[model samples]
Target: MSKKNKNALGGARQILDMNAFDAGAEATERNPLLERRLANVGAATVLFYKEPLEIVSASGSWMTAADGKRYLDFYNNVPSVGHTHPRVVAAVTDQIARLNINTRYLNSVVDLYLDALKATFPAPLSNVVLSCSGSEANDLAVRIAAAASGGTGIIVSENAYHGNTSIISEISPSALKRGNLPDHVVTVPAPSHPGQSGSIENAFAADVKRAIAELERRGHKFSAFVCDSIFSSDGVYADPPGFLRKAISEVRKAGGLYIADEVQPGFARTGDAFWGFARHDVTPDIVTMGKPMGNGFPMAGLVTRPELLERFCEDTGYFSTFGGNPVAAAAGMAVLDVIADEQLQSNALRQGNHIQERLRDLATKDDRIADVRGAGLFLGIELSQPGEKDQPNAELASSVINGLKDRGVLIGAAGRFGNTLKVRPPLSLSQDEADIFVDRLADALAASA
Candidate 1:
């Protein structure tokens, strides 16, 4: 293939593959379980690190492998509260034992959870639709936007990965490897701040304006502008809070709904606010969230204005067989309880800021560490060629990932070029754990160099 074609293919790296384990393992690296996993999943398996760990159990901020090795967990966006939090565990176990049934019949636990969940959002977003995954929530949001706006156009960030469903995959540019995006879908560059300008807000808004015009020219009516408020997949760009307002304004002006895909950054993950979009000061027309909702339990959903949901319901029926069962509701309620009772949100803010400060100090000394930015625990350390911030150094990122793993810390990579270390530990991460991670990271960077 031509050079440009090869570059295009390389740029299409899927979100999960940034630090994924290749099947081509050396003989010494292969074990019976690893062999069985490969044989079972075949080409569909997506493991982490050069030597994937067989995790047997987990707790707050840490995971234990089958061989009894423990690693500080920093790569999980799920279980935002923490892994196997006792409150969530007790709640799920008790509820499942008592009664487990669908939402077709009235259930107090479900309503209580729904009410508690709604209390977290704005008043206008009163209606909630429970679902089984973030993918389902996003899929419904897309249809609702189209139904309400009478439009088919959708816009997303260049490397956005919303979900794995067929419709969602079409809109998720990072997931498309062998084909061009459908005409109805278009992408905008990620919001990048060069450490010297407040121009990112205006520039991103202008990009949205141009994307809307492009959609119009393509004969597709603008439906919705979907994105994670943190822009996690687009390299964890979160700064100058309210930078998204202008772009969201453009989306609204064009009669397109703004759908905040909070699957990756919601439920107090962003510290400054309960929801990631809250940091941006933008009101999403439809907010979809999952993964952490049940703290690893299978539950996800969307919240929207009543009128928009009413409009969508008029066109089609909606229900999920396992969406808001009592067990899921119990798990959801427990997650909320843990976040509040233990003050995990405050902890996340403190620990995240501490790590960011340390990383920033390191960045000042290390030319290869390009940038340190993110909200709360959802932070990123961008790697670049030494003394050349503009040039991505994915190789250095890969080296640091393995190095960190060897140092008893687990992390991952992100961004379109896969040079940014994605640091998203549990909200309950303590200062000591945070310090250990940063120290190990410094060592890893030093050793890699």
Candidate 2:
């Protein structure tokens, strides 16, 4: 084949082999359930593992598969509190039985939930707009920013995955399957420090400033700079507190609003702060939250300054039929109660520190384990080729992820090169659970080796 054809085939192979769970595994047997799912579900639906685990039930930090085996979950951040906490279950059940209605009517439950949610944010972020999912919240945030700033340009990380909405997908460079970024959207490199020295903060700020200038050159006025506060999809970079201050300032100076997408790192998962942006001490103009909002309930929302919200409302009247319904409010409230009552945040801090300490020790012995960095429970372990530091070894990462699954532990990968193990577990993970995770991770590394 010609060189160009060979390169095209290599690219196709890379995409096909991107599944972290398919490495070092035997050929999948034909399962009847798998066949049924394939027939019904779209081709875009991705499943974990070459042989997918049929998870039947879950609790706390463990899930029971159809094979009657329990796996320690380190992949799911959606269950922020835990998998089906009794309080959340009871709250949803009770609210459904009592009354479930939209926010159009006067509802005491919604009011109480709103009050509790607002208390978590800074005073200026008093206005809230509830939505059904992170995608909707992000979509609305973009709209609000555009309306408030009268600008159409947006800035995002190179591999950011903000949401799945059409507008959001355009800005989410990771979601773009083909073609360059849209004219109105510009992407900056994620805040990552591999080998390059100097301040990552200043570097990031410079990138933001350049993106804003480029947007202006193209006659697209800057509207917003949106990012996953923890840089989750860009491989979970949460270090050097206050690193984001410079970039946020650049966005504000460029007359663009800062929208913090807290879908992955919110709700005390970071342990250091309730929201990931809080760790950087940067107050976003609009904060979009989801995934862990209701401890797995289909709930998300955006918190913003009252003036911006008022301007958005004036531009386009906003109403969500099922956004802040009584049931969702009840579930959200229950999640908050569980977070405080169970002291999950403190537990996350303690366990996360322990895990990172153990992993750092392991890294000293393992050449392939390039870097172990994160804040609280949101962590990433970068894999590299043996003896070649900083050279991402995506194949090794895939092998380790699949190996962990075979050993009854669940995990995933992230980053532009897909070589960073994304280790985000439930906030309620116990010390014992952390020990299990570290042990399994060590074994998985060995297996990969």
Candidate 3:
């Protein structure tokens, strides 16, 4: 780590114990929202939906909650670059102080922004349409996919979660709003170990083939096969991108589109490549992005082949008041620049290697930690029973998460049973910070045992 990173890590370490002095009766009373939020989350039995002690501010890879407590943040995959990164903040601020408006008129920021973004994708997938969030981008993707394929059925992973919009929710098996049992949606199991032995890549391809075959048997036309290329919710599986090649080929043969949802795993969080789909060595028909693209400035977009999007334009126009405006473009541009200039992608590669090594060692020591899987920055620590077939233990997972929070580190959990601890920190996290995080996580694991 550089001297700057060393100092920043030291500063975060210093504030870890500050909450000890005042995290008491007065603090709880003053923030009634913090207290009541847990009750609401508990009433619903929702996973990690509570207010979470009201973090007052955040910068880089650390967040300072209400009680003057600072915690190392390893859960915010959306802050792809970093929290309140000075360059991104300045870019947005400078643009807003000058001029920011719709795309009805030509703007340098929007044009320059699109140019930089287009360089990240394959040549055929060059055009871009911006939106304010991943949900909105996914919504636009649905319109484009439906238009391009002339089909209504969409295929997704069994526990996949695309977004919260009605169309996305219908396809996302994780959505509890309407039970996610939509008529036009086809769900298939995601690729993971400990389930089937022979090449999970083959299993994924078979699943896609089976889904398409079933759709054909039922005389149903499929619009698209949508998947998070990294599949964060399906236990952070990032192997065998070539595994989906046959499935995608089948989808295309069936006149369906292949949509890679990169909302949580975009912008080089997966390391090795800018888009998670690139890791698979397959170019997607349509790609949706959000979360880290703006580094928390509410900017996202759908990029696709001009030919694919043209079908939608022929029918109805897609427009959002806040999409691709100057401010959003500026933030997005800054994030891209930081990823290149700061070499944050390389940093994610190195730090993720370190984290994975440590976690793997921990898993060997304790059989409860079923597995550790993911590609750079995005990771999942699976919790299971002792010497058993990695069954989901949601209770133990929650205990470890709350325990880590108490120790001044934050992480997110996903998977169908909410039993995997998702550890996707900011891409800018340093080696020193990684050490602190690993130490604390080990402490949490010991406490759980």
Candidate 4:
């Protein structure tokens, strides 16, 4: 943590007299919505609502919750742009106030939306289909994949989380609840540092080979190898891009389409490239995007080769009532425009580098930190158990998250072990805000230690 950040945090606290508000473990004891939402997530009592500090409004990299508290939000990766960015808000408001309609009726917004979207992809994937959420997009992708290959079998990573939709859950290993296993889906271990002897790339490649062998033995062909570009739910394994590339190659050779789930790592969140799969130097057969594209307006889409889309359409009509509503298209357009005009991608590069360096420094100082990994703003700090070499420390990660919250920063965790501190703030985050987050995290780690 830098001295300047320490002073800024201190000044902010002093100005608000932050201690006066009940910003602690029991802060949400009185708020019904906070309490209900907590219980709804099955993480009851895992969080608290701060009051007297309720958020009233916000712009750029900040957020005002409901109780007057201003949070330097670092957990909202879905809002690819900063919160309430004027450009986005203006576009949506203007469009809604003027004319908001669905895709059934042709509109200028739809044309503008698709034109802007085409620039983001390679030549082959030029067709577009819109949905209201990433889950729907994934569901549609599954249907398209199955239809294209004439197979029902699909393969996914062990801890991969595509979406909450039922058909997608049938293939998502991360959706492993009691009595919730789906048929016809082959599961494979995600790429990770395997047992200290192999790199994540080696483990991933080996797993891909084994999976393909099993498919052959079973005498079944797969339709798709669907996976997130950055497996956020598995862990921050950003290295070895060609690892997935190799796996996709094998799957394609076996007559399956390569599907890249870019819900969490798209919109230039990764520093090296705009799309996470680009880092692998692989062009996917189908690329679906959502979450960050509309800055939380609930718009998702899939881009694929023109011929493949035509084949899928031959069987059934693909349609969604509110998928590409004018309002959503406007919001999506605004996000892209802001990303380009503001150069948030460059900001992500600069801040992500600083964040990785700082986390690595902290990892050196603390043995509990087993690994610090990721690309661009989508980074993770994995904590280790006391006597384990590679086991994840879920409890310690939870403590760090709560402790940071107590100190005025909000973050989330990921990975199968639940031991990774996920840090993905809005793209508008400034260096000053990053410095504040780093300080809070360092302090939280030290206190927990």
Candidate 5:
């Protein structure tokens, strides 16, 4: 509930600020490799912690740094089934040894994988297009929306982050570094309220309507209203199931397609549902997924109605050099099998609830803990001034993040002001790992105080 600060840190820049790193004079002197990394890695690379942990190996929910210290990981979600899962590894290895090529040839593996992937979606979302990353998937979704709706205008959340492609970057407000949004794009506030008065949904929908009107005023036809279902970059707003229904309806009324960006909350990470949009009881015209889809393997895709796919293809045929390759298919299939056999969805729900309950108890003792909100394994803890709950405490968030790293735990921050702690561990995290994170977080809070 904090008021917006104009000068606050925004977007991925906050994640890359040099002040957030822990490379002290002594630590830097001991590790010449840090200088080597700086020399080789691009300036755009975003590393975690003040003194970056040189992670050497990982397994399950734990990772070992070069210092011979093992830290409990509470940040990474890409390894949904868990880090270095034997089944996923074996699948990729076997496929690599047999065959690995583009989708041009008649491949049974790709066919079988496509069937398994489609089985995860609703009946109408029968067509699939494979890509190599979430950015590529989103880029394609935007093109499809423009083709299907014959509109160039796109709407997104205030701090939404879709991808890195040029077209997608124009639609992603979080990726914008200067001036107002591009002429063809507009934004609406995310649904962040807990629905104390049951007005949050209506207010959000109204915002969407206003944005649509503004776009029309500027002589741009509405194309799509894309959103990350959990609103991760807008500070994790997954509450009051069906809150997104009204906004989606508004988009449809405006003759715009609803593109659900499931890069963050897909593949059973949300506990009760496989897709974040499902929690709202609505079906999007296009669904794009990435990150955890291949369990660390490079794979992403979009699923949409067959009509939309056909319309898009009629304009310009699509083909990806590395998309849906045999190895990627093997990895994707293995990830699905692991999720089903291991019952990760149920585990996500149980552990997420337990962690939230523990954090709520901590909130009772610490006034700085302004709010705790999220679903399943993806959650956020909002920090604010002790007396003024409307003033975000980014300094405290930064301190806590660094303190946790010092105590052998890893996490990150998100939101417009970088005041919300983002906790999205792998779905395979154990109850004991959750307890460890809670304890470490408690210690980090104390240290920050």
Candidate 6:
């Protein structure tokens, strides 16, 4: 949509580059912390905003900067249960104080957490392998799929971002700042945004069929079709429930597994279901989840059919030093407890619908907001040129993001074109907070305009 926005989506996932600090730009302020941070992290530093907020602490849906300014936290993919949730914090603190050992030990907390977690999954996905991050979970899931299916080819959405590990990065087209995808990886278009009338179920399934054929021709036997149920990196496409059924059916017909990477959409974030894939009513052969499992604790994992794990372990065993530890298990259990005890899933649905209605009302008044679509708290606001709804306006999206920041609200961008504002507030977000976001977004749009 732009020669100017070429840098936004050309390489490196837009989530990384969008609204990222321009290290090359001249700074008018002399900040000691910024200088020290840059010196420490060097080129690897990925700070948000040109002027980067110095966040010192966070709680619930707000983050406090070093300057004592509080900003609504909407951009972070982690902290799904909310930043610094007390239950998760207390659970981790207490468990670590008593015992924090690897899963090799027979810890009741670990078993209790596993049993409770497994109960949430479909019956066949009874086995769970714990890891330290979503990337690790995805890496293991892919290997399991390949081992079980006896193939190497994997299909993903064009801009899908599963994780940062070698295997996952190869399939994550958005992660690459340069170079083509590996031969074993193939990509299909994301499901269309809601409100675009068509048989979306069939269109997406057809694309998977094409990807499968291409992989076959490349000598990479189709092993799996992997994607986050919400397609978070593909601009958060969540609509027309059950659209994934046909695609998974096609993958199964070709003897390929359907791997659901739920790092972003699981843990009641989608509101309607315990797992994002459940909203589509399709059972994933392998499900990879992280980010929100232990709230902020470093714990992630994959659940799959017992046979898949059994087959994989025959070749090589798997273990993570800190994964499934008593402390992590405690945190995990607390997160699960909070979700159930607080009725957060129902709250997510209510608030999400509330915000969506407000955004749609704004869309009527402002043509720049091309569309407002997504489920629960995982919403996307697509920006376009006024009177030209299809024309992506990344510059506008960036401007609005910064503008929102200045207005004390925080958000991020997504989409292949980097024109969609990712409105990912915490599932525990209240109606009052929801209104603040929408009201400020309108102000930001007007100010940016």
Inter-residue clash pairs, candidate 1: none
Per-residue lDDT tens digits for candidate 6, residues 407-437, read 9998999988788999888788999999999
lDDT of 5 by residue, 51-148 (tens): 77789998899889998999888888898899999999999999999999999898999989999999988899999999899999999999999999
Encode model 3's per-residue lDDT on 1-449: one tens digit a residue.
24574343231111112112222324433556644654575543322323345678999999997789999999888777889999999999999999988888789999999999999899999899998889989988988988888788889987787888877777777655333366678888768742363787767777887888777667778889998988887768887656677778878888899999999888999877788988888999999999999998988899999998887899898778889999999999999999999998888988998999998988888888888888889888888766553455666777788788889988877776667888899999999999998888889878988
Winner on TM-score (4 vs 6) = 6
lDDT of 1 by residue, 1-449 (tens): 24574374354466777898878756554478888999999999988987778999999999999989899999887988889998899999999899999889999999999999999998999999999999999999999999999999999999998998988988988776577999999999888943234588888998888999999999999999999888888889988798999999999999999999999889888888999999987789999999999999999999999999999999799999999999999999999999999988888888889999999999998999999999889999999889988777888999999999999999988898898999999999999999999999999999998
Cα deviation in Å at residue 271, candidate 4?
A: 1.4
Preferred candidate (TM-score higher): 3 or 6: 6
RMSD of each: 2.4, 3.4, 8.8, 8.1, 2.3, 2.2
Candidate 4 wrong stretches, greater than 4 Å: 1-28, 34-56, 194-199, 386-389
The local distance difference test score of model 5 is 0.87
The Cα local distance difference test for each model comes to: 0.90, 0.87, 0.81, 0.79, 0.87, 0.89
Alpha-carbon TM-score of each model against the true structure = 0.96, 0.94, 0.89, 0.88, 0.95, 0.96
lDDT string for model 4 (1-449, tens) is: 24574343331111111112333456644867655655676532333323433457767777776756667787778777888888889999999998887788999998898899889889889999999999999999989998899887778877778887889878776556445445577778657655443666666766776776776667666788888878887776788666676677678788889899999999999877899999989999999999998997889989999888999999889889999999999999999899899998898989999988988887777888888888899998888776453656766876887788778787777776567777899877788899999888899989998
Structural RMSD, model 4? 8.1
For model 4, where is the 10-residue window of minimal lDDT? Answer: 11-20
lDDT for each residue of candidate 2 in 1-449, tens digit (9 for 90 to 100): 24574343332222223562342356557678866776687465567877888899999999999989999999989988999899999999999999998898999999999999999999999999999999999999999999999999999987888888888888877666667778999888888752243788888898889999999999999999998888988888998888999999999988999999999999999999999999999899999999999988899999999999989888699888999999999999999999999999998898999999999999989999888889999999988889776567877888888889888899888877778899999999988999999999899888778
Residue pairs in candidate 3 whose N, alpha carbon or C atoms collide under 3 angstroms = 55-65
User: Per-residue lDDT for 44 in model 5?
Assistant: 53
